[model samples]
Target: MTADTSVRFREFKMPDVGEGLTEAEILSWYVKPGDTVTDGQVVCEVETAKAAVELPIPYDGVVHELRFGEGTTVDVGTSIITIDVAPGSGPAEEPAAAEPPAASVPTPTAPAEEAEEEKPKGRQPVLVGYGVAESSTKRRPRKQAAPAPEQSAAAAIQAEMNGHGAAPAAPEDRPRPLAKPPVRKLAKDLGIDLATVTPTGPDGIITREDVHAAAAPAPAPAAEAVPAPAPAPEAVPVTAGARETRVPIKGVRKATAAAMVGSAFTAPHVTEFVTVDVTRTMKLVEELKADKDMAGLRVNPLLLIAKALLVAIRRNPEVNAAWDEAAQEIVLKHYVNLGIAAATPRGLIVPNIKDAHDKTLPELASALGDLVATAREGKTTPAAMQGGTVTITNVGVFGVDTGTPILNPGESAILAVGAIKLQPWVHKGKIKPRQVTTLALSFDHRLVDGELGSKVLADIAAVLEQPKRLITWA
Candidate 1:
C-alpha cells in the first residue's frame, strides 16, 4: 500500500493587533510564494491604526499563497496567506483541483422513471437518514437546476479557465462585478453599485477610480450656458507634476487625526498659559546628567519638565481625573500613567509610562529614555499608549513656543513645554539674563475647572522655577 503524502494548507489570518481594531494595511511582504519560512519568522509587516507591527508566521511551511497584495487593507480574521505545511510530500495543486470521480457524478443520461426514484423525497437530504420525519412544516423544495445567474457565472469562469472563449453572457445574467472586497466596500459606501461602475482594471475588474467616476455627478445640461468662472489655484493643472501631491491617510496618521479631531470637539478644552523662569531647572538638568544616579540615562530639560509636571499633578491631584460620559461620573485615578508625546516619521504618537508617579527621578528618566527610543524606532505597542491619565508634549524640541495641545482622547490634561531661551528677567532686584520658557496646560473643562487648572499650571511653574520643589513638594 502506498503511504499517503498529501499537502495541507494552513491559512494565517489578519489579527486584531490593537484593541478593538478592525483592519490593518499590509505594508510589505518579506517573503513571496514558494519561499520557505520557519515557525515564528517575521513574514510581513502590517500597519494598524495604532502602529506598524511585524507579523510572524506561526508554523514552518512553504508559502503557497499570498491572498492579498501589499498596500491592501484587510479585515481582521480574514486569511491573508496560505502555507503548504507538507510542501515536498505531494503536488500542491492536486489537492486543490481534485474533484469527485466521473462514476460518482449524478448521470444526466438516467431514465426519467429511475431518476424520479433517485430523487429525494420529503426528507430533503440531511445527514444520511438523519432528516426530520414528514410534518406540517414543509421545507422549501430544492430547485432541480442551479440558478440562471450562478450557472452563467460558473460557465463563463470555467470557459476562461479552460482557455476557451465563452459566449458573452447577457447583460441581465452578467457575472457579479469583478472587484476586490475593498473596492466593493468603497463602491457600496459611495452608494454606487458595482454593476453600474465601468471596469478599467485588468481582466474586466472594476477599479477604485471607476467606482469614483460612476459616483461623480453628471455634467449639468449644456443648454444652461453659464459664463466660465475664473480658474482657482487648485483647479489649475500643472504639467511638471510638482504643483501638489496627495498622500493617502492611513495607519497611525489617520488614527491620530481622528482621535485629535474627536478630542478637540468632544472635550470642552480649557487651556491655561504661564511663562516661567526655568533657569534653575536647566542647571539641575546638567547636574543630573553628570550625577552617577542619572548616569547613562537621558538627562535633559524635557526630563526635568516631565518630572515637574508629575510633581504638579501630585500637588494638584484633582487634575488627574477623567470624565466618564456614559457613567456620568468624575473618576479620579490614584495612579498616573504619564504620557510623553513623541513625533515619529509615521505620526505623533503618545506612548505613556505606566505608574510614572511612583517612579524615582532616575527611574522616571530611564522610562522616558526607553519610551522615546521605542517610539522613535516605531516599536511602541498599543498598550503603552492606552490608559494614560495625563500627557506632556514638548514642543520646545521643535524650537516653538507653547501650544494649546489637545488632550489625548481619554486623558484629562496635556502639558505643552516651550523652547527654553535666555531672556532678560527681573530677578530678585534687577533685570538679569535667565532661562525662560512658556507652558500651556490644556484640560477637559468638565473634569478640571479654571481654578484647578490654574493651580496645576502654577505648581508646575513653581517646581520648574525652584527645582527644589520636587523634593519638598513630593
Candidate 2:
C-alpha cells in the first residue's frame, strides 16, 4: 500500500520558461480535473514578463487538481497541478477523488508565523541545470483585531444600507486587499493603494480592472447651482469613462517600462538629426522586390534603413558598445545584434537578429521578415531579445517625422527613421521634388562623443542617399 501510494500521485510545478523569470501568469489551462494527459502534452499557456509560452506536462496521468485558477501569477517551483499517476489502482483513492486532501493544498491564509513554520525548508526541484530557486513566498499581511462587536454590527448595518453590504474594515483590520500577484504588481506600477480600491470581484478580491479604475482620475464636480442648458449639436458628450480607458501595465509592458526608466536615467543621451533624400533607396527597394534573390521577402524602405544602420556600425565600430558601470569599462562588441522595435498588442518588444553584421542584404531581409512575423504572432523567445548591441526604430510607417528614440537597456545607440515624403530640394543644379526623410540617432554620450556619433549618423544618411554604397562599403 505504501509503494502504491508513492507512485499514485505526481505534482507538476511551474518551470522557469525564461531566463531567471521568478513567476508567470497562467493565461489559460488546457486541462482540468479528471482530464487525461499524456507525457509532453501541453497543459497550459502562461505569459511571463518576456513572452507567452505554452507549458507541457512531463508525466502522463489523469489530472487530479489544479492548484491555481487561470490568470493567477504563480511563483516558480510552486506546484500548479497534480496528476493521479495511477488513477484507479487503489480503493483508498476512491473516496478522495472528489476532493483533494487539505494537507495537499497550500494554506495561503494561514498566519505568517504558522506558515513560516509549516513551509518546508528544503529546496524544491527545478529543471536540470536551473538549480533550486528561492520561492517568491509572499506572507499575508496580518489583520488587526476587530473593533468592539457593537461597533462592527453598526458598521455592517450602515454598509448594508448603502447598497454595497461589505463594510470597510478599519485601516489596521484590513487584510491585504485580496489580489493576485499580477494585480498587486499593477497597483504598484500605477501608484495606487490597493486598500483604497473597492473590490467588485467575487469574494472581495481586488482585480486588475479595480486597480486601473482606481488609477483613473475622478470626474470634476459641477460648480453651478442651477441646471445648465444642453450643449450645441456639434458638442460631443464627455464622461471620464468615455474620455479614457485604462490598461493594466503588466508582462512585457511592465518590463519595458522599468527598462526604459533605467536606461533613460542612467545614460547621458546625445541625439543627432539629419535630413536625407532617399529617392535612390526607395528605387532600390523596388528593384530588390523584383530580384529573384529577394522574392518572397519583405522588401521595404525599413529594410534598407536597417542595412544602412548596420553598415554605419561597421564603419564606426566604437559606437556599437555598452558602458559597464561595475568594471568602469566600455565593452565593445565585435558582432552586432540588430534590434528591431516592434509594437504588439501586448506592448513594445525588441526581438533582435543575432550576428546581423554577418548577414548579406537578402539574408538580412529574410531575418527581418521572420523576426517581425514571429513577434506579431507573439512567439518571440526571451533568448532572441537578449544581447542586443544596437537598435533601429522606423516611425516612418506611422507617417510621422522622426523623433529621438530611447535606447534599449544595455545597448549603445538607436536610430529613428522618419516618413519619406516628396519635398522640393536643390538637387545637382535645380530645386525639384525629391524623396526626403529625417533621421535621428541617439547614443550614450559617455561612450560615444559628438564626432563619432555624428560620423555614424552621417554614414547612415549617406548610404540611404546612395544605395550603391552598400556594395562599396561591404
lDDT string, candidate 1, 1-474, tens digits: 001112145556677778679999887788887789875566877888997776767556677767777778888767677666655443423223132221111211111110011111222111111111121111235469755674454464344334333444345544465564446667767777787778986547676668768877743111212223212113335469596866678889999999999999999999999999999998988888889988888889888888888888888899999989999999999999999999987789999988899888888887898788788777676767888999998999989988989999988999999999999999999999999999999999999999999999999999999999899988
TM-score of each prediction = 0.69, 0.69
Candidate 2 Cα errors over 4 Å, as ranges: 1-6, 91-245
How high a TM-score does candidate 1 get? Answer: 0.69
In candidate 2, residue 378 scores what lDDT?
76
Overall local distance difference test of candidate 2 = 0.73
- Which candidate number has the best lDDT? 2
Q: How many backbone clashes does candidate 1 have?
A: 0
* Native-referenced Cα lDDT, model 1: 0.72
User: For all the candidates, what are their Cα RMSDs to the real structure?
Assistant: 21.3, 20.4
Candidate 1 stretches greater than 4 Å from native: 1-7, 94-241
